[model samples]
Target: MSHKPTTVAELGEFTVLIDVRSPAEFALDHIPGAINCPVLDDEERRVVGTTYVQVSAFEARKIGGAMVARNIARHLDEQFRDKPRDWRPLVYCWRGGMRSGSFVNWLRLVGWDAQQLKGGYKAWRAHVIEQIAQRAPALDLRVLCGPTGSAKTRVLQALAAQGEQVLDLEDLAAHRGSVLGAVPGRPQPSQKAFETQLAHRLAALDPARRVWVEAESRRIGRITVPEPLLQRLRESPVVEIAAPPDARLAYLLRDYAWLGDDRPALADKLDGLRELLPRDVLAQWREWALAGALAPLFEALMARHYDPLYARSQGRHLAGLPNAHRVASDDLSDAGIQSLAGHIASLP
Candidate 1:
């Protein structure tokens, strides 16, 4: 029985859409729910890419065609060896190109109900752009603005725990939104992966509810927010959480004390600040560095850099806010978070 190609959206809820792009391409971006099942492994994709760029198109096709066939044969022997006869698979590649199309053809020939995404990942990307762009404009957005170490993430978590709608943009991007925000030893995903993650998270939310999110610039590392999301955030309500300088300093010290123990890592992370800080300030920070007074230096660093940026973002956001509130909680303890949640819940 010849198998027909299926639109990914048409794949019944149980159908699995497999991504056959190389790991690098897939990492940059892919459909939200798709799993990586490369028909051409990393090295083979590289070889094919190079051949297409350097050698004749005919030669590249000949080599790529054979390699893809071999990969399919191996899958039948190993990974797909036990796949049930009724297993329905939807496959796609970059732009629904030849790699996925070829695999889909092979799977269909083998008598399973296999199909390919009509436009592959390209179609998925378009869908994301359209939804985020048009729908976000009408959202009741809430921007969670606060200084560094003010427990913004903690506040967001508590809100979610209490059944309030919240979006952890940093978590979605697998980033922390500051030089010190990087999780220990975890590499960030590619920009495409970040968007895919963001879109999936957004799609799962009910647009009728207010979406609470941490205040962030358009960019986190190399990943930039899509235009639609940025536009929506621009007009959202801004709530600033104020803390005394000492309180902010203490908070930062507690959150980032581990980085202080490693001077080399600290210096590397601070390298970007050289252009912004004066040599004297840098020397002062270094003196604190040598004396292991990192907590104080970190406080000074916040006042000098992070605080200013936060203030500027707040200024632009405040003007557009239909309702802005200032919360004077520095530590944001359990009671404080619960109180804040109650306040937000009461809002119309």
Candidate 2:
């Protein structure tokens, strides 16, 4: 029997979840733990679509069906050879159409219980978007506000260590939320993937308990925070952590030491600020990067660029900033972050 699951909740019952969309489609986003078993390779999908539009629907179907069958045979021989007869799998494609239907039908014929998601990946994506829209407003969000290099992310980690519910958005987005915020050797997730991650994280929290998150602009790298969640963050009461310039510089130096190791990459990132800063200033910054004089460069960046930008942006976006609870720390060491976390957790 083939099960047709209309909603993502029903997908939880399956032991295995498979996305039968093209690899390109699966790379964009799918269910969190779903494995990709593309029914059609990227090139084949494009060929089929072109054939469908230019030749005939029947011709396209004939070609696509043969390709899907060959791929399914390979999957059975390689990916599923060891599976028991009783193994159950849930499969989906872009629209729960022929792609997943063909896969599920074949699996059922092979003596396994197989189900097709009723509306497929499209349905799951819609559910995620809806979840964010519905649950974001209900969350008890505490926005953590501070200028660059204030160790806001570190403080969030410390808070989580104490069992606080914290939404580490940068972790989810795979970005630090700045031009130079890219993590070393870590590529950011596709926008849809980021949204799926955000939806799942937000879903696991208790609305009754407070949730802490760093204050971020609407955009984080190539991904944008969903508007409803962004609105909640902007409206939420803030806990502002203020650290001295020297302390902030030290934290930046220690935390971003990786940038020093890649002087060319660092120089390239600085070059992106060409429009914002004078060419002469950018050249000087690049010189410091190449010379490994990061401390002085970081000090100048904070004082001249990031600090002023943060002040103006926070004032404009965080309308509730005036009432924000302020906590000052002279050190951003682990102990200092833990202390700040304790203070934030104790807030009324």
Candidate 3:
């Protein structure tokens, strides 16, 4: 008699899907490639949850179960409608509990190759921790460290386009690594979610080949770097990119043009500097913002704060870490980053 592949580990590499849930829930943490197809949206889930607590279990189950069934049916009819007949999709709810079990059973009945993740997202998270904490240190690392607006992300993008090995921490984290780093029109995931995504992305890369990454502090907005990878970053060599003031300013404007008319966000991000600056300096900062003198505001902010902070941080970190070759952005053409990348790759 033939047996079906029941366990997630037994499935090997397969498409993963997280059952429908809120963006916040998914952002807080989720399995990699597990697109959220919640059995109930936020409002519906909240309603069901309230019923479960305030009303009788029988009543809650009746209402919640029907809602979940409706959601699953909608998911099949709309989202999974165009999926190929042979497509294998793994579905899981929070803990491979009742919600996911019901969906899985329904999928099987409908003749789709559907299976529930044994322990659901929790199991996948444990897998991520084990893989990153235990397995990542074994790989060769190339850290790309630079001040804000140094075009590190662009460099990484160029490298990938040229078939070089690269891992985008910022891309995976959905942050730009600064007070103003949040992408316009896009919301970043929670820090925990970022680490989960990072582990999954890192796991897929060639560990023997050097992986290129931008240098980031312990925290990027709400997310902190994972301990294992953070340790690796601390030990890795730094590739400092130098640029002129004008170049840097141009890069900043170019990078953040999406903020177009959102002067308030700009003001709010800069306003956080009040505590950092002296009274007079703070007044001057406010004046610049009020006067629409963005260039001067940015320049002063970078010089007085960011540059000094980075210098000190690098100085401290450099005491224990070796320096890799430095690349001047002005000196390097569009191809210069690649040349620099090649040189870094050649290092022992």
Candidate 4:
């Protein structure tokens, strides 16, 4: 008998996972580590769908089948040629319908252990959503609250190194959770992809142990935190890290100095602040950016813009913050951050 379709729980048993959806569909969201091996290119999938609606299902199937066969053959020749006979691959399409079924059937015919994902990508997506909802509420979350440049993220890393559970949400979102938080040359993941990544991390965590996370606004760059997880974060016990203005300014200069290299990009980002700051202040900041005087510019931004904004936002949103365990450091050096992490980890 031929192998049957497998459940999502069995995903780990397979050595290779293939997603046979069109490029556009796969780009929107996919299972982590699954390779795209589309049975239909984006244009061809569109053409087949149009033909099915306007012309005839029979005609569409005929054209689509031929295209799928050619594409699969090409994939086998170029991508899968060296696969060992014992290789086990799991395949899925949009709904585990024709696309993945056809691919699995062919792979099995060639004497490979191939299985289809029972409900395909849609099933996996539903699983992700369900897992996040179920697991987030059960986490022993500890929110790390601080003003900008307090080195909260660095502290989270230090905690992780010390074997404490930490969820770096900003890293998952590919952003630093600020107006200028974007990492150069690294675009943020799609919102769906971000959630999938978050869900995976949440699943790996031990719910009974405390999980450290940085405090963030609802949105990070283009991605929004899922409500279930965000709710837990908001209500968690808080650890507030405080530092002197000079210490924070120095840290900001070291951490974000790369922004000074691209004066045009830095100036463009500064434009977003015009409505909030005085016109003269905004112009001066821009002038400093263009002139590459980053240290003074950073100091001014910390004192004037970020510090005041952080105070207001913390008071308004983080009601639990007032009762937080406070850790004050005048130095944000590696030793200081690690020491802070040690103190946080020792918290009950």
Scored by TM-score, the top model is 2
Query: After TM-score superposition, what is the CA distance of residue 157 in candidate 1 from its true location, in Å?
Result: 0.9
lDDT of 2 at 250: 86
Backbone clash numbers for all candidates listed: 1, 0, 4, 0
The C-alpha RMSD in Å for every predicted model, in order, reads 2.4, 1.4, 3.4, 1.7
Candidate 2 lDDT, 253-340, residue by residue in tens: 9999998898888888998789999889999999998888899899999988999999999999997799988999988977887898
Global lDDT scores for all candidate models = 0.76, 0.91, 0.72, 0.91
**What range of 10 consecutive residues in model 1 has the weakest lDDT sum?**
5-14
- Put the candidates in TM-score order, highest first: 2, 4, 1, 3
TM-score of each: 0.90, 0.96, 0.83, 0.94
Model 1, span 237-306: residue lDDT tens: 7776776777667666766777777776676677677888899887787777766788777878788988
Q: In model 3, where is the ten-residue run with the lowest total lDDT? A: 1-10
Full candidate order by lDDT, most accurate first? 2, 4, 1, 3
Q: Candidate 3 residues 73-160, lDDT tens each?
A: 9888987778776767777767777877888777777777777777777777777778789756775767776666577888788767
What is the per-residue lDDT of model 4 for residues 265-335, given as tens digits with 9 covering 90 to 100?
89889898888999999999999989989988888888888889899987777768989999889989888
